[model samples]
Target: MATQYDRIEPPLARFIARQNIFFTATATGDSRINLSPRSTDALRVLDDNRVCYLDLTGSGSETSAHLLADGRMTIMLCSFQGPPMILRLYGRARSLFHGTPEYAERLAASYDGEAPLGARQIVELTADLVQTSCGYAVPLFSHEGERDVLTRWAMGKGAEGLVAYRAEKNAVSLDGLPTGMPA
Candidate 1:
């Protein structure tokens, strides 16, 4: 059975905090829908109605592009090693790029000066609906650890190199949408 909630309850918060990975889903009016798996301790719940996640540089910037076109997003998390539950956060979101004032403030407060290299955007979500369903069929898996490949690559390239790589790979989505990337 599924249950809907007006806000993120205490139990849901506990469930969210224990998850190793979460998925984000988004789509524009005409473009393809995108579902992305994200990790790296990037998510934070600001309040009952608001949440934010840091967007690291990757091969594609579909989420940023899609959110720019349409603010809708759904973030989902499932218990893989405990009691069965699937939580979904449905909301509108906007992406704040590195050059923006909001980005600076967020970084200063949350990351100080040690923000991740090649950081692209921060996605802020305003939740309007929260739901949970029985995830009895969800497979149980143990979390090993975070992958170091991306961090190592970014460290090797440094800042300027990362900017160039973003230009080459993260500037646009496969459907030719602008990712709000700085030039």
Candidate 2:
């Protein structure tokens, strides 16, 4: 029912590219685990063992904080459109801040040199393990499309407003951990 691999094979990469949403799970030694559902075209499979996703401006930056406190991260995707399958990538992750050369390079390579509006950082993960399981119990759902609310909100907030908003809301996690976004 389950199998493990050292890296993401080509077929797995294709499966990931077709996924409309994925989940990220992370935590520190003493902090609550953070699990989030991410959508849009923000994620990219950089290589057989590396992946990156554009971190957008959200209400909280728990993933960023957890990654900073403890590098362990896991990304999971379940098949909803076709045959039942589940994939998980276990790895260490780091957030690449804007203005850094790493961030710029990732943005260019993964995002076609255009950073989406309200994008604050890039979360890159280097996988040590990949696992696949039969998602027999998973229910099927069709991906209608990406929502534009985030984009519209970012547009309304503009650049300066987003900066201020992040400073106020994204700088700290719910457990009082610093996300290193800016305070």
lDDT of each: 0.88, 0.92
Q: List the residue pairs that clash in candidate 2.
A: none
How well does model 1 score by local distance difference test? 0.88
What candidate 2 gets wrong by more than 4 Å, as runs, is: none
**Clash list (residue pairs), candidate 1:** none
Kindly list the per-residue Cα lDDT of model 1 for residues 25-141, writing each as its tens digit. Answer: 999988999999998288888789878888888889999889888889999999999899999999999998877899988777666634688687888888899999999999999
Each candidate structure's TM-score, on Cα atoms with residue i matched to residue i, is 0.95, 0.97
Using lDDT, give the best candidate's number: 2
- Model 2 C-alpha lDDT per residue in residues 64-112, reported as the tens digit of each score: 8998899999999999989899999999999997767888998888898
The Cα error of candidate 2 at residue 42, in Å, is 0.9
- RMSD vs true structure, all candidates: 1.3, 1.0
Cα TM-score of candidate 1: 0.95
